[model samples]
Target: MPYVNIKVTDESVNAEQKRQLIEGATHLLVTVLNKDPATTHVVIDLVPTDNWGVSGKSVTRLRQQQVKEAIQAQAERRAQEQ
Candidate 1:
């Protein structure tokens, strides 16, 4: 089982966003996390932006640098804020 608590912005969350996170996390459990889809469990929880950081920078201090670029891109395209 894999439990993933994703800290994201309240300004950047939605139902489809939640679904995408869950799906993506589940995929990770099966792929990167090395869990078998048939026997694994996955859970997702959304936290406020205050709880997330990127490359040593807190969400509030976001600088839009390369390190946060992919993650930010994912959020924009997937409706998520991870």
Candidate 2:
């Protein structure tokens, strides 16, 4: 039996997408490793943004920083065009 675990942020993933993921994972293992589809297991874990970290900052904070930077860049561009 083959097992696959997929982790993603809790960003409202619907049922159809989850189904596709499971099917795709199963197909990949079957195609690449010659594993049996019936015996393959695929699990998806949804983690909160605050729980996932990168470069010593949580994803939530990183996303906030990205938005702030985008707004600043837009303001700078508009100022230059005027």
Candidate 3:
């Protein structure tokens, strides 16, 4: 039996997408390694954005900061063009 663990942000995933992820992971094992689909287990761990971090900041905070910087850059570019 083969087991796979997939981790994603909880707020970014839905039921259908989760189902697809499980299916795809299982299929990959079945196709590549010739593992039995029935015996393969795919587990998804949805961690809260606050629990996932990079550069000492949470994923949610990083995303917000990126959007803010993008908007600010766009505004600055427009001002320069005008």
Candidate 4:
């Protein structure tokens, strides 16, 4: 039996997307390793942004920084247009 674990941030992932991910993972194992779908196990884990970090910063912080930068850029653009 082949076991696959997928981890993603606790973002807006709908049920259909989860279903597709499971299906795609199963298909990949079947095609690449010739694993039996019936015996293949796929698990998805969602981690909170605060628990997930990159480059010494949490995902929540990174996302906040991104939004701040976007807003600043937009303001600059408006100032230039005026």
Pick by lDDT: which candidate is best? 4
Model 4 stretches astray by more than 4 angstroms: none
- What order do you get sorting by TM-score, best first? 4, 2, 3, 1
Residue 46, candidate 1: Cα error in Å is: 3.9
- Candidate 2: misplaced stretches above 4 Å? none
On TM-score, the stronger of 1 and 4 is 4
Relative to the true structure, candidate 3 reaches a TM of: 0.89
The RMSD of every model to the true structure, in order and in angstroms, is 11.3, 1.0, 1.2, 0.6
Question: Cα deviation of 32 in candidate 3 (Å)?
Answer: 1.1
Residues 1-82 of candidate 4 have per-residue lDDT tens digits of: 9999999999998899999999999999999999999999999999999999999999999999999999999999999999
Please provide TM-scores, in order, for all candidate models, with all chains considered together: 0.46, 0.92, 0.89, 0.96
Clashing pairs in 4: none
Ranking the candidates on lDDT from highest down gives 4, 2, 3, 1
The predicted structure with the larger lDDT, 2 or 3, is 2
Task: Report the poorest 10 consecutive residues by lDDT, candidate 1.
Answer: 40-49
Q: What lDDT would each prediction earn against the true structure?
A: 0.69, 0.97, 0.94, 0.97
The parts of candidate 3 lying over 4 Å away from their true place are: none
Candidate 3: tens digits of C-alpha lDDT, residues 1-82: 9999998888868889999999999999999999999999999999998899989999999989999999999999999999
